[model samples]
Target: MGALSVDELVGRDEWDSVVRQHRRPFVVYKFAATLDGRIAAEDGTSQWITSAESRAEVHLLRAGCDATVVGSGTQQADNPNLTVRGNDDPRLDLAIVHNPDRQPLRVVIDSNAKTPADANVCNDAAPTLVVVAEGADASHLNGVVDVLKVKRADRGLDLPAVLTGLHARGVRAVFLEGGPTLAGSFIAQGLVDRVVNYVAPALLGSGKSGLGDAGIRSMSGILRLELVDVARSGADVRLVARTVRSR
Candidate 1:
């Protein structure tokens, strides 16, 4: 089989435009983890787990999407500015910016309005949307940032509703950025259409896992993925896989 170009590594058959016309926005849960499936150290220091090349590829992945989302925990910890800012690292294949002018919407799934007004995500780099519960008090953030209210679920805000809200705002694709617990919620709900994982060569013996409680108790009910693309980015291996729709 011939090798696929880096830009062709997304885990999808249909173009995002086609998929967006269907249900909610297409969701891709993406994370970089150690060889042992640890996304962060015990101290929660997770910067630069993968190589520079891998980090650079992530920019391209975000650019292809319409929004980049993260849960409250991730927002409180990382305070990311989810714009599709190009990386400083030179692309191994060729140094190119996929959409230099494109800035995907930054979305925060802050069910309780936990996002601080001064958080980096609230900056003017990109438009920010904070998803809170229907009755949650987001008045404090009213003028600070845009807010969307969704029905609450047992664990958090209804993820399906969040997607629906995003779709209404013209977001066709979402780059589900993470901090394990949120990723697990998406996986458990079967809301994620694709999984993009960057595995570093190193290992973290014990730390936060790449996924939290995903509602998997037995092997029989485990979710399976069909590998769509595999590539090497610097010293890390990037795997792009889509959830198998059929059991």
Candidate 2:
């Protein structure tokens, strides 16, 4: 769509990010894990799991989506800025995807509104939304970032409702940067459409698994994926696959 038409001639009256048609945004989740499927060490150290090249590749993916989501655990643990980063580093790929300013909305799933006011995700680089339970204490986050109150689940905010809300707000795509437990919840509910797993060569015998329990009680409940593409990103292997929707 870029090479032929729709170049700088394209302009938006409002924030309508529909790249494709659907009831809700198309979700593509990504994670980097060890050879043994660990996401972090027992001490919660997860820096530099993938090489610089592998990490750089993710910027392109973020630029394609309307929203980039992470759970509160990730925000607290990583303090990710979550932008495409080309605005910070011109050498990055965000400048190549579209307008460098056309970045994804940084979303944090903080059921209790745990996000701090000075969190890096709340920076001015991009818009941010903190999804919390119906009556969460998001008052503390008011002037800093947008707060979204959704129905509370047994353990967290309602996952499906969060997507429905974003869909209403003109978000047609979502990039889920998971923190294992949140990713597991999305998978258990069959919300994730694609999975981009970055596997490093090293191994951690125990720590946080790349994914948590996906509500699998037996083998029949297992979720399978069809591998679409595989490539070497520096020393790591990038696996891109689509979920084989059973239902």
lDDT values for all models: 0.80, 0.77
TM-scores for all candidates: the values are 0.89, 0.86
What are the per-residue Cα lDDT tens digits for candidate 2 across 1-247?
A: 1110111111121113223333666777899999999989999999878887767767766766789999999999989989885445454454443443566888999998889999998978788989999877888898998888999876577988999889887887788997888998988888887788889999989889998877889988778888767778778888877788721
lDDT agreement of model 1 with the native: 0.80
Which candidate should be chosen as best, given lDDT against the real structure? 1
Instruction: Give the alpha carbon lDDT tens digit for every residue of 90-171 in model 1.
Output: 4322222333235788899988888988999887767889999998888878787899999999878899899888888898
**Candidate 1: TM-score?**
0.89
- Report the Cα lDDT for candidate 2: 0.77
Model 1: worst 10 consecutive residues (lDDT sum): 91-100
Quick one: best TM-score, which candidate? 1
